[model samples]
Target: AMHPMRSEHIRAAVKRARGNRKEIVNKIEESLTHCLAREGLEGEVLGREKHIYGIYQKMRGKRRAFNEIMDVYGFRIIVDKVDTCYRVLGAVHNLYKPLPGRFKDYIAIPKANGYQSLHTTLFGMHGVPIEIQIRTREMEEMANNGIAAHWLYKSNEEDQPKGTHARARQWVKGVLEMQQRAGNSLEFIESVKIDLFPDEVYVFTPKGRIMELPKGSTAVDFAYAVHTDVGNTCIACRINRRLAPLSEPLQSGATVEIVSAPGARPNPAWLNFVVTGKARTHIRHALKLQRRSESISLGERLLNKVLGGFDSHIDKLSPERVQAVLAEYRQSALEDLLEDIGLGNRMAYVVARRLLSESGEELPSPEGPLAIRGTEGLVLSYAKCCTPIPGDPIVGHLSAGKGMVVHLDTCRNIGEVRHNPEKCIQLSWAKDVVGEFNVELRIELEHQRGLIALLAGSVNAADGNIEKISMDERDGRISVVQLVVSVHDRVHLARVIKKLRAIKGVVHISRVRA
Candidate 1:
């Protein structure tokens, strides 16, 4: 009776008296004669006996009984070539019953740290389990010392650093790239340390190249591991030849293909699921750059908006006047001053006044409210409370670090601050506002069979997308449904509501504002 086993399995097997350790050892050695005697396939049989670990640390980290973990034991065979490693595997499995699904050929798909070997679990005599590893002699050394083994191995210079050493060099090069993009020393170390963590899942690319990623890593991690550019523009991923979520946890042996789009930018949401330090570091760097560009654009718009009222344009201002404003604000450049204004750290109105200090003590009243084209990017956000859309009268709230938060003019959340000229300003939707707006709706409807389906069909027919929907039973006959829907504008929303109102069971519907 033979199969695969762990250290615990070996300990349990020994307790059952499965021929003594010497008999097992002799049988394993005899595997060479059974399969690898003449075909230039031979290697040294090395004993890798069970080794114990710190009791307290193992107990605390594994949260398992100490005695249960002591059953591990295995053997390692070091051959001369990669092909022989596999041949010996056949020989060993022939001698001992190898456990099904317990065999792993890391040689085909090396670990992230560049370690390659053939691992198998077998059942020895009397139902005892045993673990074994087979690899080339160089692999054994590389496994033990990793990149540091480079200095220890005294191979001929002509041998060069191909295989393990090359992988190590590539890894080191990645670390240098992370260091360059990291925001600070702490960020660099934090990002670099995660890559040093153990690589547990091995995956493959579409081109048959194997990649080793840490367990729990996502496709974004795989994308970043491929290259920073690929990661930045990746819109989706295909795992194992099928479209999969970018945040899906990767499993070993799955083929991953990243789908990229031209001009597509990294989603800030990816930060939530990305596990690799490289992905995190690169995403943050890209976002920082994106925000800087957005801030500069927004700052220019704000300055120009205010200058409109004083009957002056930012371009019309003299260089000396601009320099004086920067000096007064202790800003090194006009861009810095504008960024501050864009982020709401400095009031644009105040800056506008200072920029015109030389003109005169009295300045003409500013023009109409700033127009929002819905392209302000990260600096400008719509208030979640009111969910304002185009065609609605909106006001801008100057929130520190948030730039502008747009809300319906009637939204009470900003009622107190609305009167404060420094913190709030009127805003008008530009004629060419782009993109959809999300709004939550509460629908009172009769509790009828297939009610949800009807609602969905109606909204779908009206060209509206439902982001989320929840139902609350008011009683046996009536129910209230709350749904988050995306529409292009107020008109689009009205159209969706009208379609829903046509349904027989729908009692009433109104947009949810809070």
Candidate 2:
């Protein structure tokens, strides 16, 4: 019964009783002593008893009953240094035949919660896979008590030297902050799960430093983890000495380097895929600042353009009076108010009204709100119920909270809103406004294999994005297809309908209306 234990020492006295229950417990305690006495290890070796949750996970994961599983009794080895952890790993590997793929080097990468160790499932003399973990004394301390080591020990002032576990904890706490702002508790818990069980890839920096990140992580994540300033300016990235897409997935052992630009900022779409909290937070922060800057620039441009048309200058409006009016509105800054006006959230005419009243300048009723021309913006929304394009005669309704919602003048709900003039609003598309709008069309075609392909080709020939398509058999000879497609306003809608109608066996094509 004599054997080597990694975290603790199996004492001489316990070796005599091979099958005694109390003696087995004593042997585990003795193993802890042997490991703790080794040079350069720190922390106490308190055998960790398996909790209910841990037992449940093992049983459920293996689809086995509680009594069928073996080796529930395991002892934890606590150490004080990262380097010592590797040495202990070497010692254990030398002593046991580690089951292939059962050895994990978490000491180098660490977990989201900052736990790090060399974990191995080894074939002991008893011919069973016994789990053994080797860790530095510091890692052992963190495992016993989570998140308290930040103040428990006096540490270096350098950012990274505070330990990877501390860094990981800070990152998780930041994620918790974001989750609170998101206001979804379920989503918050789900995000925490993602952080914990992340499928990870380990890569090396050119300088020989190692980084462990979630699998499929991009170079953008790597850049941000290096430093926020570096992330902000990341222009390009190289993996293993070749230029790669910023969104390219990283392998477990690639070498990565970031190429940066001085003034580059993160794109908003980066939020769609980034895995780490550090990268996510930095990208979100950069995007927020960028949006603020963009809004301010847009506002200044619009104010200059509008005032220039009126033969007046923004400076002539008197900053003091503007500030006073803004204070009444509970706005903190003039630029913020101006940005709101430019973004169509706040009407310029309203701000103008406030300004005119405060400055004691007599002015006539304005032509229209800055974005909407009178009842025009109110009555001209493209209704999902009818999906009217530009060619359709559209009417506006004064929808509560939604401002003006437009519908085809002949929309089925027209009677309901028309009867209530209080909810009616005048609206029209400006003469030169140009953009693509979605419209749904119903097509009747013979049951032919090429019909769908032909229709798709015709639609593409006219340049449109297919939003949705579905078909149903009406009978043996015909099928009715619903096509939700986009067009450059009303005139283009006619062209596409005509084209689809020209296809062979296409009997009829007409717009779908409520």
Candidate 3:
């Protein structure tokens, strides 16, 4: 049914199927018990007919057709030992034709919820499908009540022995581990759902230890399941003695060997294929820590560079000076301030200026634009309004939240904040700027076939890298083209513009701001 039905409808359906279910269960239990007795096997045989509400809920959850629900009639055979359970399973299979691919051996590889059993669906009299479960008494208790089965047997801690239900205890411990790693309550609950996955594949490690992961899990998931460190440093892996991609889905009984390097780190792409909550949580935690550490280092360097301008150093700063800076920023500690700067949450130079001002030290003033090193890292960003290049005479404006913004001195946008000299910093081009800068140009060209190609070729000839090109058709004959190109310096950009002007169809070319 596409929609859920009323309670009365479900009750009526269960009532109609009750007699058939009882007959099927009785026949299967009789056949199994008789077969086991003849084979000199001793165990308890039980049968169950699921309640109407339980069946309805399961059907709705799985969105299965009414006829597709096969486990309405179930039987369980409980033995004294694990081996006896397997013997019961083999005997049951011999009595009835077993359905292909309809058997699961959870005894060898327990489910994440600590469920262990041998499940088989077989075709019985009149082609009716019946499901049989074979397990030991202990496993029967676990499959029925999960972790609560342990508490039901032991009245108190003193009555319980250590390592009793160890697998269930480990599952509970994993829940706590996920809780600690999750960002919030909702995330913790979501991770718990992933841990309770019903379908799984059993794979082996190089050491021959079995790992039961959810079906469709990748090599990265296996790595994390083995150990967090292994997942973090995993660079490559060999599956069944053959090299395989990390994203490849692992198969049952495959021997997986992780190849890791000390310097290797997690890739963000691992989050896409990993099915286990443990892998996703560990990767996210590692990446966050990595970002924080990098930010701290970058912040420290930026602060030291600013201090060096005043003939001082970060290591030489006294405790009192550091405390004063922290107080100025309203930060509880120095690391917090440094981390904020490193993450671009605060400006390093501003903090340095405030600290020096508090010390009653006269800060040196640049007579003209201060030269840039182009290697300021996260501490400096070019102003979008002017898009200053290396050869331009630029002024540095310290935005309140943004670290530093470099703009051409003649930019009209500079006039708005020029009254506040404290926010205005002198800047000049570095002697050896390391990287190219983005510059935009506007070209008025006569529209013709292959004209765009000619323009692109000319830019390449002048060693300019085209970043983007947007064209507007003013009319069929004329098109206004905007090009964004990467250049080393003003001279290189000027050469590119000259080359573009020499093109056959180009009428005029001018540098566009921003």
Root-mean-square deviation (CA) per prediction: 6.1, 8.4, 5.8
Alpha-carbon lDDT of model 1:
0.83
Best lDDT among the predictions, by candidate number? 1
Best-matching candidate per TM-score:
1
lDDT of 3 by residue, 217-254 (tens): 99999999889899999999999999999999999999
Estimate TM-scores for all models.
0.79, 0.65, 0.73
RMSD of 2: 8.4
| Candidate 3 stretches greater than 4 Å from native | 1-12, 51-54, 61-63, 67-72, 148-166, 203-209, 236-259, 324-332, 353-358, 361-513
Lowest lDDT block of 10, candidate 3:
362-371
**Candidate 3 local Cα displacement, residue 417, angstroms:** 6.2
Q: Which ten residues in a row have the lowest lDDT in candidate 2?
A: 6-15
- The CA root-mean-square deviation of candidate 1, after full C-alpha superposition on the true structure, stands at 6.1
**Cα lDDT of model 1 by residue, 214-325, tens digit:** 8899999999989889999999999999999999999988999999988988899998998898899999999988887888888888888888887788899999999988
